[model samples]
Target chain A: MIGVISYQTGNARSVLRALAAIGAPARLVASPDDCDDIDRFVLPGVGAADVTMKSLEEAGWPDYLRARVVEGGAPFLGVCVGLQVLLDHSAEGDVDGLGWLSGEVREFPSSELRVPQMGWNSVDVKSTHPLLAGVPSDSYFYFVNSYFATVGDDDLLATTEYGAPFAAVIGRDNIMATQFHVEKSGPAGLAVLTNFVNFGKAA
Target chain B: MLTTRLIACLDVVEGNVTKARRFEDNIVVGDVETVVAGLYQQQIDEVIFYDILASAQNRRIDLETVERVASRVFIPLTVGGGIKSLEDMHLVLDAGAEKISMDSMAVKNPELITQGANEFGRQCIVVSMQVKRVVPTAAIPSGYEVAINGARVFTGMDAVEWARKAEAMGAGEIVVNSIDQDGTHQGYDLTITKAITDAVRVPVIASGGAGTVAHIAAAVQEADVSAAIVSSILYSPRMEKLTTVAELKAELAHDYGIHVRPIVAA
Candidate 1:
């Protein structure tokens, strides 16, 4: 069973729909107890960092998720703001993140390019990670954010350019993340989600 | 580089794509997913879903439609049409809408824009204004009166002044729709379009009166607007408007030295 983290942010329902579209049954888990029966976990968010963390804390998801990913060794995936919370810290909020990865989230500095980087853009696939198994290089993905993660380690799987090229996809061990909305990114996006589900099933 | 956006407007009602104009005639478009999939195939830059009768019902956005479109389209989706409060805005955004365009609610309570901006950031909020040209009366001068909920509220506010105020309240962009010229197929109300564009610093989307490719080109060049939003031209097969945005942009560049970015399909 696949479990999606329920917070105040958007994209959870679409993620659930995408999972179901690919013949996978997923449940929306708002609490740690709700995640007990699920085998795989997905974190989906849309808003700022501080508020998202607050929602997670208020709903008692931090403790539950920490136990699920760290102790239970469940396969996990994060999308957009969900990806930001996996970092050590986020510029969007004062609170520290779950710190699943050694990185800090920072805003994409305003320049000639539009803020929020809204629309479909090309992604340059870097590594041979399972999340990007059959995904082509220079494939386009949908992105809508003002901030992204900058990690020290070389777990970056894909990079996309707006004003500047930033890490669009990151993965380490059982935990993976995409700054773009895979549930929204057409056929290529479905391919990435299918790959993630396959990776979870294989594990 | 600033790109010309090709936006697909989804007229939604009761969680479905309710109605659209084809040859100036109302036709029932399919569900949000099917329509969005067709628009995605066209490689449109962005998609806007307007709830025609949502505000009158005093409800939030259609979240079910947002989820359906978000799962299908891989582009920026702006959901509008009954967004009245911050909580309403949150409902749409949480359902995968990239931006929320407030109409009647923002006009009634300007603080909604401020509060929404403070909470979700300005980029997530868009103030949609319906401008109707009104002759100068004893009480009002040569200005446009803003309407909400399908000409429900005739807020004696000047359209240009409202654009400026909305900008001051932290609107990331402004969508100016001319009610008088809507579905006319003649052209956009350039006078009003130019007024709103010059009044605000943010990008202005010229909507409501795009009949042909020439009208779209004229709106972009003469009005100096960032985007020319056309519904009938693209959706109506009987209309001879260009199908691809690249073709239209090229025509505009060739005709008027105005460089417009073409929306490429994924």
Candidate 2:
């Protein structure tokens, strides 16, 4: 079963509906108890990093997600702010993140481009992974964010350019995330989620 | 590289997508869900639905329509009109809207903009301005006045100043809807649109006037807007030749040299 983490900050409903639309049934895992029988997990978020971090911390999600994704080696996916909170720190509210990944999130330089780079932009894949299997090269995904992750090249799976190239997709081991809204993006995005549910199945 | 966006603005009345000229004389176009789903299939960059009668009639926005559309359409959805408080914003967002647009309510209580932004990040709050070209005054130095209640009442706030203030107050995006050009189909009011876009750092969407592909191209090239909201030429029955989102994006890319999202072959 697929468990979509719901911390009252992310658009879990949309994510749930999107998953169902692609023939991948899922349920909202609001608490750790709801994570039972859930082999695959998805964290979908929108809003500030600080705010989302606060919600996750208050709801005791960090430890549960860490145990499930980091230690258990289950397939995981994060979207937008969901991707940011997995890093070590963020410049959004000068807040420390989950620290599962050795990286930091910084605001895009507003002098060169709009702060929240809204709308559709294509991603350039950096590595072959199951999460981006069917998604075509140069396929645009919906992005509405003011910050991007700066991670090591080992974990960087894809990069997209706004003012400059930023990490649009990241993956290490069983953990994967995208700075864009995979559920809200068009066909390309749906492909990512569909690939995610079937990530380790083929193996 | 980031591309300029082409947005579809649906003016909804009584749960049906309506086409109007200058915000009056509405004509029912089609069911809201079907039209929106079709636009999504055409690869429209984003979609904004304004509940035109919600505020005037003092009612809540149609969340059913929002839920229906957002469920089927996998793109950013922004809903405006009748959003007065943080609770209303929550309801809309819970209904699957990515952004909440405040117009007259923001003008009445400016704190609502900041409050919503504080609660649900600035990126989810969009301050929509109903602007009309008026005589330049000391108070309205931009030669444009902000209108409220669907352009029924004109506020003394300057359009350019409002755009800047909205940004300062944490509005992530601004929609400068020209009352004069709304449904007129002539084109966007570039004068005021350019003024507001220049005054604010946040993404400004040129709305209220969109007739042809050239009009949308002009908004992007001349005003330097982030997006252009097109309505009439896309699906209105009044139009002699209705265009698809794919055709418009193709024209802008091929002729005007404006970069848009590459079309995903069906």
Candidate 3:
């Protein structure tokens, strides 16, 4: 059974529905105890960085999730604000993150481009990853966020254009994340979720 | 590399999908779910559902329609119409709406925009304006008049200036609908659209006059707006040949070099 982390954020139900669409059985797990017997885990969020951190702490899932992914070596996938929380810190709030990856989240510089970058945007693949298996180099995914994670060169798997190139996808061993919403994305997005499930099965 | 967007607006009344010309003559279309599901297979970028009956009754947003559509459609969903208070906004957002648009309420209480932005973030709140172009008289200059509640309330405010105020109050986006061109299909009101687009920094969605594919292109290219929201032409059975969003996007991509992805079939 695949476990999808259910914190006080958006896109949990949509993520579960997407996994189900790909013939995967996924359940919403609020706490680490609920994820004891699950095979892999998925973290989903769609809100401010500060609020998400508060929710994770309130629910007491951060330490549990970190152990599962770091010590237990369980495969993990994150989306939107979920991806940002994996970094060391976020400028959205003055709070520390999971520190799973070496990076920090910062607000996109305001210009003619709108904040949140809401709508479909293209992704440029950087390296080979199973989670990005069938997705095209120019494939577009639905995005809705105000801040983006700035990962190191080694951790970047894909980059997308807005005002500047930002990390669109990141991965390191059993951990993976995407700044875009695969559930809302069309065929290309479903393929990403399918690929992640396939990776979970292989692990 | 900004691309034009094609949107379809569904007016929901009493849990039924309906369309009105001047906000008076109502005609029932197909089932709201079926039409939405069908539109999801086209080249449409996003879908907006206006709950026309909910606000007048002073009730919360209709979660049934939101859940039914969100269950099947994977694209972005925006809910509007009768979103007066913060509680109303939360109900729709919790029900799976990506954005909540406010019209009469925003005009009545401008602080609602700031309150919503502070709570849910600005990106989720969209301020909608119904504009009518008025000729320059001795007292007022040649500008756009703002209307609300299906044009029932005339605020006598200029559309451009009101857009600036809405932005200052933390509106993430603006939807400018042309009352004069609505359903006429002559084309969008370019003068008013350009004014608002120039006055605001956020994304502007142009609505109200879309009869043909060319009209959509003109609204996007000429008015320099971010998205063009259409209803009658895209939903009318009489124009079945031109109803499909894929065909419209293809024509745009081929004719004007605008790349738009066709919505995948369910």
Candidate 4:
């Protein structure tokens, strides 16, 4: 079973539903025991970073996750703030992040575009990965974010342009993350979840 | 690029879509699933279900209908009507709605907007506004006024001003509709729409006056809105049985040079 991190971030339901729709039924992993035997992991987050990180800590996830996802080499997927918490820090809550990946989450550059950059925008693939397999290049994915991760090109999997090019999808090794909401995106989104789930199963 | 969205709205009354069918005779009973699913097949960008009388009748959003419609379609669903508190918001979001919009209740207690955003994130909270054209009074120098409680209570507040306030309250997007041009088929009130769209930093959707493919195009080009709500015109027989979301997208592309999601052919 896929271990979906349960917290106050409010994204678990959609992610859980998407997992089921893609035939990857998951269990809500609120404690360390929940993650011990799970084959893979899905970290879903929404709302503020500090709140999410606090929730994660309250559920005793940071240390457990470090061992399970990083050391154990289990496949993982992070959505929205789920993707943000992988960074070293964020301007939103002015708090530290999970630091799983080397990066900093910063607010989008103020421009003609709206702050949230909310809408269906195309993601240009930068590197080929299992999670992106079967998903057409430049296919539109739903986005609703005011800040995006500023990560090294080494970990960036895909990029989307709103005011400026920012990391739309990121992954290195068994850890994968997306700045957009996959469940709300429609068919293109389902294809993404399918690829991620299948890739983990194969591994 | 964030292409314009074409949204299909379902007007549900007294917790029953069937009951409202008499007044809105164009809508068929038990067609919530069929209509929304059919629209989904045509690749409609988003679907919104409005619990028409939930507020007036002192009830809540039709969660049963919302759940039924949501189950039949995969695209994003937004539900509005009588969303009086955070619990009501949770009820609909749990029912599979991606976003929850508030109008009357939002005006009644502005804190609801901030609270909803704080708990669910700004993306999940959409503040819907209805604007009426009025004389250029000093308070609302823009000449467009805000109306609450189904347009029965005019707040003397400017539409543009109210939109800014809602956005400040952490609303992610604004659905600014026209009361003057509503159902007039003369297209959205471009003056107010453009005013609000230009003033806000968030995405704004022009609602309540799309009568033709051209009108939808005008909403995009003139008001510079991110989306437009199409209802009455789509239900008319001229629209080929109200399954014209794809057709509207096609017409916008071929005639007006605006493109949306490619139609998912049935």
Candidate 4 lDDT by residue in tens digits, A17-64: 777777777877777766656988888777878888888888888898
TM-score of 1: 0.80
TM-score, model 3 to reference: 0.93
What lDDT does the true structure give each of the candidates?
0.76, 0.89, 0.81, 0.80
Give the TM-scores of the predictions, in the order they appear: 0.80, 0.98, 0.93, 0.92
User: 2 or 4, which is superior by lDDT?
Assistant: 2
DockQ of candidate 4 against the true complex: 0.57
What is model 1's DockQ versus the real complex? 0.22
- On TM-score, the leading prediction is 2
- The residue pairs found clashing in candidate 2 are none
Descending-lDDT candidate ranking: 2, 3, 4, 1
Flag regions of model 4 displaced more than 4 Å: B14-30, B236-243, B264-266
Give a tens-digit lDDT track for model 1, residues A17-78.
77777787787887776666898888886767888888888888877777878777888999
Q: Give the local distance difference test score of model 4.
A: 0.80
In candidate 3, stretches whose alpha carbon ends up further than 4 angstroms from where it belongs are: B135-142, B237-241, B262-266
**What docking tier does model 2 reach?**
high
Task: Return the lDDT, model 3, position B39.
Answer: 85
Error of 4 at A150 (Å): 2.4
Instruction: Tell me how far the alpha carbon of residue B49 in candidate 2 is from the true structure, in angstroms, after superposition.
Output: 0.9
DockQ of each: 0.22, 0.82, 0.44, 0.57
Candidate 2's DockQ is 0.82
lDDT of 2 by residue, B90-164 (tens): 899889899999999999989999998888888999999999999999999989999998799988988999899
For candidate 1, the docking band is: incorrect
Model 1 C-alpha lDDT per residue in residues B48-70, reported as the tens digit of each score? 98876677777666677677777
